[model samples]
Target: METIIREDTPKTPYVKLDGEKGVVEIKGRSIPENSVEFYKPLIDWIDEYGDDPKDNTIINIQLEYFNTSSSKCILDIFKKLELLFKKGFKVQVNWYYEEDDEDMFEAGEDYQSIINLPFKMIEMEE
Candidate 1:
C-alpha cells in the first residue's frame, strides 16, 4: 500500500498515512467547509489499510481547533482505528494538545473514552 499524504490548508490538517509503517499523523486545523468530503478519502484509506495493517499502528492527532462537523468526522476516524484494535492489532493514538488549551485536552479525553483503542494525551508546550 502506498503512503497517503495531503498538504495542510487554512481549514484542514496535514495528513500522512503510511501503510507500510502503520503510522498516521494529522496535524493543524480541521475546520473544513465540507468536513464529510474532506474526511471521506481518509476514512476510506484507513479501511483499505485495515486489510493489510502493520503489527503496530500509531495515530498522532494534533489539531489546534475543529468545528462541530469536523468533530464527527474525527470520531469516524477513531472508530476505524477501534475496528483494527478490536481485531487484535496493536494501535495507539497520541493526542497532542497545548498545555493551556483545556478544550482540546478535554476533546482528547472524550475520544479516548469513546474509542476502545489505547490513547495517550500529550501536553504540548504552548
Candidate 2:
C-alpha cells in the first residue's frame, strides 16, 4: 500500500503513514476547512492496510488542537484501529500531549476509554 504523507499547515495536521513500517502518525493542529476531504483518503488507506494485516500497527497522534469535525475524524481513525485489533492484529495508539496541556491529555484519556485497543498517553516536553 502507498503511504500517506502530508506536511502540516496552519489549518491542518501532518500525516505520515508508512504502511511498510506499520507506523502511522498524525501530528499538529487539525482544524481543516474541509475535514471530510482531508480525512477520506486517510480512512481509505487504513481500510486497505487492515486488509493485509500487519503484525504490529502503531498510530501516534499528537494534536495541539482540533475542531469538532476533526474530532469526529479522529474517532473514525480509532474505530478502524479497533477493527484491526478484533481481526487479531497487534495494534497500539500513542497519544502525545504537551506537558502542560491538560485538555489534550484528557482528550487522549477519553479516547483510550472508548477504544478497546491498547493506548498509551505520552507526555512530551514542549
Per-residue accuracy of model 2 over 2-120 as CA lDDT, tens digit each: 88799999999999989999999999999988899999899989988988967999999989989988988999999998999998889999999999999999898888888898998
Report model 1's TM-score to 2 decimal places: 0.98
lDDT (CA) per prediction: 0.94, 0.91
How far off is model 2, as Cα RMSD? Answer: 0.9
Span of 10 residues, lowest total lDDT, candidate 1: 109-118
User: What is the clash count of model 1?
Assistant: 0
* Candidate 1 colliding pairs: none
Candidate 2: 10-residue stretch with minimal lDDT: 45-54
Judge candidate 2 at residue 44 and give its lDDT.
Answer: 89
TM-score of each: 0.98, 0.96
Superposed by TM-score, candidate 2 places the C-alpha of residue 89 at a distance from the truth, in angstroms, of 0.8
Residue-wise lDDT of candidate 1 within 1-126, one digit each (tens)? 989999999999999999989999999999988999999999999999999999999999999999999999999999998999999999999999998999999999889788898989999986
Q: Per model, how many backbone clashes are there?
A: 0, 0
